[model samples]
Target: MESSSEFPTSPSSGTTAITNPGFPVSDTVLSGASLPSPPERTSSQGGGIPLSKTASNVSSHSHRQSFAENQRHPPPSPRTQRHPSFTQQAIQDLMNHPPPNRHQNPRYVGRDWRDVAVGELLQPDEVKWAELDMSIQEATKTLFQSSPNNVVLVRQDSSSKEAMSTFDHSDLNAYLLAVVGLAKPEEEQVALYRDISVKAQSQEEIPLRDLQPIFRKEELVKIPAESTLDKAIEVFGGGVHRILVTNKDSEVVGILSQLRLLEFFWNEAVNFPLIDRLYTIVLRDLQIGTQQIIAVNADAPLADALFLMSSEGLTSVAVVDNGHNVVGNISTVDVRHLTNANSLPLLKASCMHFISVILSERGVEHGRDSFPVFYVNPYSTLAHTVAKLVATQSHRMWVVESASPSPSAPATPLLQASSSLPPLSTLSPPAISPGRTGSPTPGSATVVVPPPGAITTSTPQSPSTQGPFSSVPASALPGAGLSGRLTGVVSLTDILNLFAKSSGLRPLDPSEQRARRRRSSSSSVRPTLDIGRENGRGSVDSRR
Candidate 1:
């Protein structure tokens, strides 16, 4: 059952400064949302699965498991500082060349990031496609997508010396994509999501299971359904654009996402205190999604999901069970099969526990929904909510419709499961009877993707440096392993694509291509043939 001891928030205490590991800290700090992991074998000893980002060591912290048993969550870690010099220089370089567009500028006076979406900020070229996990798309009946936020330039050589590094704004987009779900994590790439959520309660690092999970009790900001825009302005301060439309049960009926208020007050409305205009920005006005939800079964392949995201566009998607209530969601670049689906029978002993924990969380299944998921009671405070998000470094949450719906048998052992995510057995597809249109819709199909090749992914111990992978060219990887799971190395090609798009430097058209007769060609500048939609809207849009 949900708790009803309403905990409402007061205004924020504002930003505070804190120190990082050698990095200067300010009140405006950010961190990763990941979980802890078990011990890892050193890469130097032999070929082992690369570490998951959120890995940790567990043997010393037996007492900590009880903390997690109590539902205390972990906190996400701040971005790591262990990058080579090249990576650092790249970041500084991007800071130097800022976008000129008022809408695209990250630091425009009075502008807040939460208030905007990529559609408003992205150039035509800037909008690259990403794949959605099958669960997210099928559960929501929408193609989920995100644009890259940042692109880091890493230079590695045989001598093990770091080369010149640069960070481009484009890189930032890629980072955002990874953060939200537009990009996929490399297989064995360890990322700490909520460093705090699954970390040892003690200050020192510990194994994932040993982390004392803390679910804080904090006040939240709640808006009554009847509250007016003018009234909301007085309460939320400068950026309170919209309010949540909730019912008497405190269930959200709709919301006034910031975009809602912007449409009404864009250029013409009187400039009132933003808090005041908040209430009237109804959920109906701000709904950025469509009515028809498209979804795939949880077992579906991520490649299928990515095809959906890249072709369709999505921000976040709702995961649903057979009953159709939303359970979870997946976003951005975290949906890679390499990192999330390495079925090595037993994960690499060298692969750290924290990263595995993150991997487990990243690919969790909520009943049958395709998206990864996490949960909280309906009554947690906003502060509690924020704490949970901060701890896990995940932006979305799942408030199970029924708090005491079901309980499971006590966990028997660790080997029974890889990470802490529920074993795949519990996941099942949502049930939807077919409409007159056709074959079984997305929900009817099984979306299970084949697990990745052996998790102890390493090349054969041959004299030549080329590993087993080198022996099998991407084209001959049996199925889709090569193109689908190649984040192991970052190439200049990916970086080039990122920069060109951010700058809106498009290529020529087919006619233009022929006329110039040049060497290089552009993606946006393509041989134009109609790849119009199956829907007839393409024939006569007045906007065109």
Candidate 2:
């Protein structure tokens, strides 16, 4: 893993001495927020995954298992000394890149969501599209080579007379599609959607439209181009992970994403501190503390896992046993490699099946049993949050039950029955009853429950018992192979949202507020650090 010292430094700082390429200046100091004392950095063996604690004289199979786990999450080894303060050059560099058109620039300025218009930072051009009749194989190729966004917009073939008009407001519903990928540990490939079918022994071309998942208009999170950033944040905090920015015509123009927003705030936090002090804040004081835990069963089909992630706009999901104990976790990246040219089962296979396959392929008995899981107590400080993200290069961490009823007995596992959903092919057509216009109205689709034992998952034991996974000691696995009940999740996006809502950069004065109002009347105004939100007008308007 890259050392924190290796973190990229701002290019603007001229006077700050360069210690090394990745390390920040060690002795530089500034003033404003009360910075906490730096904690001693410890060295671990893996990058993100926890290591297995096998006995030194373990079997060759145990050695291979240990080796595989380290490959996935290599422990860290200390490389550089910790820096005590921000360099003068770094501070000066930040000052030079002042936020556009601010009424006042303080040593620390808290910016609000309303100040910037959605149009200014909009990225409509990033949306990738495919033809309605395009083959799933072709779409997968397009996504792997050119698109990084999660969803693909499917449009009618250009050869048709009305191809251009197919993008009209009404057509938005028809174009929404999500891609699914591999959901097992140790497995890696380009990502593809769950509904795309590939025969077990042969590659068949499936129509992209056939695999498109229909989501209702109301189910989507959207914000007007004229809405404030705070409004976008409001929607995000309300459980909408991604917000589609629409114009006056209600056409989707761009997307305001949680991850991107969080990244922006993290950059600001590093650059815009009012004082030299590292601000001390805890999760209990942030918005993320109140979020409810969302998890999936360990034996759920890989397709279901992908659907939940794409619909909720999450990068990862926690895997829980029937007792609600988190057994593992799967992220978008974990499943990304499934797009490989190899013939592998996807939609119909359970997550455990994928893990088992990966293990078998790697000559390891079972990798899933030892997959690393990390958790943080809700009351943990933001400092620790930043530290973990940096140290592990991970996207998010789980908030687990701080105290368990019994260490021997794991916390309540997710009910095994929850994994009973069938492959996307078997899911009853979304319950879109016919409407007044004689067309099916786009809305919630109730899935028909299958009979008991109809949908089954692979058992915890591997089909092969001769492998090393069988001989490894139980203590070698993460959290003793049992996770506490999940309480919440904190991602890089959540951290940024908290910072955007909390960082008090500078207060707006009456005269400055009046100037803002005057400017807003003529043009869109970016948010400033104004706390007043009286009478629902918000601080951006005339300070109520």
Cα-based TM-score, every candidate: 0.25, 0.44
Predicted model with the maximum lDDT? 2
lDDT of 2 by residue, 1-544 (tens): 0001111112233322211111111110111111223447665442334345765564445434455676677544322332223432242233333333434334225654345455655664865567878765555444433222344444576433211111111111111222212221111211232233222113345564543323222224445667665555544443334555666665557666655454344444543452112335566665464235556554555555554554444456665554445555556544433433221233344544444332222121111111223455566566555544443345577766562221221111111111121122221211223442112211111122222224435323211112111222222333334445566767755554454445442222223322332233122122222222232232322110
lDDT, candidate 1, equals 0.25
Per-residue alpha-carbon lDDT of model 1 for 298-407, expressed as tens digits? Answer: 22322223324322332223333223333233333333212212222211121112122222322222111011123433333322333333333332334432322221
Model 2 stretches with alpha carbons more than 4 Å out: 1-113, 122-125, 145-148, 157-204, 213-227, 246-253, 270-279, 285-287, 290-315, 320-327, 340-374, 386-396, 401-487, 491-544
Q: Given candidate 2, what's the lDDT at residue 496? A: 46
lDDT of 2: 0.39
Q: Highest TM-score: which candidate?
A: 2
Evaluated at residue 395, the lDDT of candidate 2 is 56
